[model samples]
Target: MSGWSDSGWGLRMQSWGEKYNQSNLGSPDCVSSSDTISRPTLWAEPSPVVPKGADVTLRCQGQRGRNRFQLWKDGELQEERNTSWHLAEFVLREVDDWRDARSYRCRSGQGPLWSELSDPLALVVMTGDFPKPSIAVSPSPSVLAWTTVTIQCQISSQQSSPDYNFALLEAKSLQVLQLQSLSRSQPYFSLPFVRAEDTGSYGCIYYRKTPPYKGSHPSHTVKLTVSGPLPKPTLWAQPGLVVAQGTNITLWCSRPSLASSEEVTYTLLKTGTWQPLRNQNATDLWTDFSLPSVRPEDTGSYRCTYKDRTASGAQSETSEALELMVTGSLPKPSLSALPGQVVEPGKHVTLQCRQPLQPELWRATFILLKVGSLQPLQSQRPVGTSAVFPLLSVRAQDAGNYTCVYKKTFFHQVSEPSDVLEIWVTDASPKPSLSAWPVSEIASGTNVTLLCQGPPWTTRFVLHKEGSMDIIQDEAKFFLTRVTSKHSGRYSCSYQLGTNGSLWTQHSDPLQLTVKVSSNTLLITLSCVIFLLLCFLLLVCFCHQYIPRAADFRGNSFRRFFCCSCLSQDVCLSHHLEDPKEETLYTEVAKERPKESSVPIDKDVTYAHLNIKNLNERQTNPKETSTEATLYATLSLD
Candidate 1:
């Protein structure tokens, strides 16, 4: 009976299996419960869990009835193979607090018969907050009141989200003073008009508020300091003095007690022109501008200003204004003489100086100096345009160089001195007149004296002849020995008051002299006397040799009687006695020969006899005694 009961139980278990098998075979989707076939299945499983920076692994297992299986994680399938189970293992290489707290899962499958999804598991990545953002303030070396300040924050992470927000906090109070959102890892913040109250210790904090919100720690702190305002500036002329018209004037701006590197600019207000006096980079402490050529038109009040740059790119207040007054032009002076001419020495002369157009507006002064001498003859402040120095008796010392100077109403300004005027006094000594001594022709080898006569009492004289000059200190004459023709020509003389006197009179007119040989007139007279005497003696001798004694006897009674008696008595008596007495008487008369010759006389004998007698004796001699005498008388009558 127990065997029959066991058999019945076995029959019942077989019948239940057969029915279960028939059901699986009829449903094709039930793969794992059906016959074993090689096919793939896919499903996911939970990821592995790990601490921060720890390594971890995940596994996916397949059922034995499946021929092939694949591992999956987060709905993504991994590599597959024909095996009873598929396994996937993962190692968490590094994890932070943020990453370790994330969720993970895994799955497995083979073809269409994939396994059910695995349960989800929490992953502890074990990460802390983001590293502190680096923060800095610009103009770190120094800070000033009312200046702009900039704050910069940065994060040194490549993976950080672009939507990170940053906030600057006062480190001492931990109060947020400023906030900013950044699309990049680093961002900058700026604040203008920073004052002393804004000075403090400051830092920055950053965070991301997207799907997963995270915060960052605060950065290192920086301290800020602030200073006071700039000082006031003052302006004035460098050297306080009256400036001449058309001259340059310089003004300076200064802040004696202030120390700053800020720039200074100057502006001069004159004739409606506002000139700029600064350059680029504008940090210079002083500036200068020439007035070029100042005039009365440039006279006005002047001022200066100093500017320091602010955080907002604006200017500061100006400095104090300075005042200046410019004066007018001065007068020009001149010098002249009262008579407007030079005077001779020993005569009265007056020297004068004339002030320019505005004489009454200026104080005039005069000075007269001899050139090359230190002492001035006259110096005075005249009342008007003209000043006179009346010299009672002009002398050598009175001739000199003269000059004039004058000043305007404003004593600080003066006019240029007048051009140098020269006043020369004519010399007093009279010029000596030159003349040759012995007022006749000069001869060679003889001493010649040249007399130079000056005004009665003159002491010194100078003689000039041809090319020669001689000085006669105490005398007024020049003597030359062995005078030659070469020494003959124009000669002149000059006289001075004294030997050493500078004054000298004008030269005298020249005197002319000629030189020749000596004693010509007497020699010519002697030659004429000798010639006349010889002619007279020859006439007397010619008369004596040719004249007849009978011509001579006609003028003398004694010689005439002697001749007649001889002829009548001797010759005629003898002849008559020889004749008869009657004839002898008549014949005697005829025989007497009429007391004259009937024979024609020779002209040579007549001329000779007349010539033989002396002119004085011929008138007294007897006549008619001889035939020659008769011829002579006839010749004389003819």
Candidate 2:
């Protein structure tokens, strides 16, 4: 074993690394004390409490030949040492420092195989010289469950720069809930979704960062009381009664439906205070919880609650308490239909729930519940011998298993759930067909008739349209006297087998109705005309870039006449017949006409600069005919 020299040991040392002999080192497992061996104990010498800048010694003692020891403070390992002596000494000088007030322990062993951890011992470093701080709870002390609370720890200090570490402690347990290093005169701790256990006495303490880390005295205690129990949640079970030894039963809980899309968790409970059996998350008002297969031991009261995980924290409110009784002998209550067990699809049907109980339970509440449904079909305390639930125009979907139960309203004492009575309806009739008049595009303001043909036995009909929720009527024909764009949709019709029943035949294939431009005929025509006019304007603009215009032709009439006179060997003239002063003149030039010509254009002419620039530019560059207009009229023999 190796030991370190004394000069190398420093009291300010935080942690020391160690090495061990591989042969003596055991596997990385717990050393069994089953083998006869001595365990080591650790203690701090010269008192556990010391002022800043003082010295302290930590000693580890145990049986001889152990060769190694490890020390931990507050569950964190301080150091490991490999030594020949069974006893090890750790010199910690300048005692008031990091983690000096925490509890510490040590264990000794040869290698990875280690001894049981020793009991924790507290070491207090006297650091009560800093100023005491004040504690404040925001918005009063009492808070509802799942609400946020801010606890502010402030010290009265004019110092612009704070140099202290803040800590909030539970007065009774002395447990530190918040420990932070802040340079603020007032620092707050935010507690969200605070539970019942958070209600207690709390105090704030602070300390400046110096040699021994001097901490202030604890502030005056503040009492916090969480007002309500976790809000109770609505709890119920599916296919209920929670039969013992039964398989696949679901427990459900309901909460006020929120628009928030956050999925929240639901916890199932056996009792008000019992731990949850399972947790499930969903966004709907109902959260279904599944439990393990029921057993004799599983028979108990069950409840549930929803936890809003999207909130500040996963805060929850428990549901109303509900009890479930498990027994092999369930009551056999009589269930029957009113008109008859076997009825057609179009007749009214009624289910009767009858349960036998004590004479005093006549006034108790009775419920008729259809199986697989969480809500009862009917619940009433006024029923005498039985409760009758009228299901108007019973459809195929209204048929299922049903049972009844009597519960004492005052005490909520429930009787055994009755056996399920299965009832079914026959609704297999010939489906009807739909026929829309013309079966093609219909002009606006025209009356159209959609005739739904069904078997002669059918008595009712329903018209449907694609992408719409409105049901047209209960007739074989749907008449649209005034068609419009709104009527342009896929239409179908279904006819009922009987007038009083709800079961109807499958809808016929859709007949698309295309209603042409309805009330906006004039507006449509105007829009088309405007569209054509714009197109014509665009075409004119496109051609105008390359073609000469009438205005330019009229302005150059005189020049054209002069050229015609020079080439035709005759003088020609023209005039606007409507205007007496408007005329075109050409000089007589039948013989030897001048080969060059120029016009004394007025300065008011729009293209004067164009003419002069073209003449000069063409003379300087003859091959470039871009200014070829100058060749048409040469400067007067220049």
Candidate 3:
């Protein structure tokens, strides 16, 4: 009788009791349990779903004794075999026809009344037209050893009518690795902590639960490749990792020179994502992935991996991460210099980059850029709204036009560049020569030229005035037209060299300029001089009235003369004058009490006289002796 079993093998067995009851009712071949040997058990090898043109074997086992086994198919007696042992075997060789996919039963006994038939087994042959299921793998097919992997055997919904049973098998040997039955849910086989032994191609098939016990064709094979430690490839960027907006850049993934395979597939993956950004097949050891006109969205940390087209399909370890930065995405920051942009060579200065105060950019990194530099000079994290880059002991090479930007670390969003700030480092070189044209001191409303001469390489000149905050930058010569008192101060000059005039020399020695009144006031000054000269001549005449003999005057040697006149013999003189050689003296006389009295004199004295003796001896040249007579006088007033 046709029957069904939940066990995947589709076992349909008839018990000895049923056979005995049927014999008592009509059949003579069956007997009671006391008179008949116990029923034997029958089973099939491998499975009932035999591949076309393949062989299948059925085995029957009974109580230990010599036994004769009879095989029945379609209720008809088929081939039978005898065995001296407890088990008998039947082989259906070359199961290649549709008729071979039928149910069969077997029994084993020594006598004519054989034991009851063993369970019926459905031999479901694999028809080429059977529905084929698909296989998929989780994670990746190629993984490091000891990684858990799940292989799923999925069938179409149309195949869901009959309860399905799934078997995962080794593709090479067709050996069953896992078997499971499912009523409605899909089936999957998990190889936990898979090892090297589990690495191979695997396939799966599904069969129905009941008779006609059909099985679908095997699904496509999935290769599970397990590998040991693999050498890591190298990743790098061409033209550097930091680039400007809309700049083309290439990322290279290169395998080791000693790698065994030349045919390789390279994958570039950015961090925080599992999917590859690009894939390339290359015959060479290295492959390039070009990102043209890269934007800020392309900035991230990326790594690359390569798969060798070897027999095992081995995968290399992931390459080291490379960070790419794209500038000019956000609003620009403002740049400034502390302690001024003109710095001394041995001093310290700071460049401050002030970022826009926004909540999204609080954790940005600031970068300092110098003109003509390939890479950023420095980077800093923001403190408050700005980041400060301290340049200590700056030298001439550090001087340049600098700009700044900020980037968000997480997103790699870069900000627009700040305005350029020109920095100058001052050196101890020879100072420039500072000179003024016309004169250092000049009257008001005059044009003045201050020339600063320095080395031939000097590109610019700076003029500074003492006690003034205004700085004048110009060429070597600074011209001041119609200068006023405001321009009268100590001035010094300095020179700078190199591109953008970043290097500066020490300041020159200071110069002072004096501004006086104009020519319009000269007449009043001359008239005042004439008035003083006439008064002096009148006073000398008054003193001549009190003349004394030169001999007597010579006696009063202690007296001081206020006026002295020299006259030649050929010139006219006053009547009080004596011989030219006498050396007359004039004086304002005071009453001396007849040369003995001590009474005070109230009259004012106009002059005092002094004597000269042996004047010839005092003459510097004997041949050039002077014949002129000298007059001495003292003028005083009460």
Q: Which prediction has the highest TM-score against the true structure?
A: 3
Question: In model 2, where do residues sit more than 4 Å from their true spots?
Answer: 1-245, 248-319, 325-351, 355-365, 370-372, 375-384, 389-493, 497-506, 509-638
lDDT (10s digit) by residue, model 3, range 300-343: 88999887665766677899888788878889999988877777
Give per-residue CA lDDT, model 2, range 1-638, as digits (tens). Answer: 01121112111111211111100011112111122245555555554434466777777766666778888866779898888888777777776556465556678887677777654444445455555678899877877756677888887765324555565665643333444456477777676666543555777766553323445667889976654433445777767653535656777787653312356777777753456678888877677777657544455567777655543334556666665544333344566777655456667878776767557657766667777876556777765767777777667887667777666544435566676765545564445677778755888888898888975435567888889874646567778888878889898888654444666667788888888875578789999999999987876554332222223435346434434433332322332332232122222223366564485544432222234556677799888877333212122321
Which rank order by lDDT, best down to worst?
3, 2, 1
Worst 10 residues of 1 by lDDT: 2-11
TM-score of each: 0.20, 0.27, 0.33
The collision pairs in model 2 are 11-93, 231-318, 232-318, 232-319, 233-318, 233-319, 234-319, 346-500, 346-501, 347-501
Evaluated with lDDT, which candidate comes out highest? 3
Residues 436-530, model 1: lDDT tens digits: 78763687668888888865536677787677765656678778788777777778888764334665678898888776654654566777788
lDDT score, residue 48, model 2? 41
Q: lDDT score of model 3?
A: 0.68
Q: After superposing candidate 1 on the true structure, give the runs of residues whose Cα lies further than 4 Å from its correct spot.
A: 1-350, 354-381, 389-638
Q: CA lDDT, every prediction?
A: 0.50, 0.59, 0.68
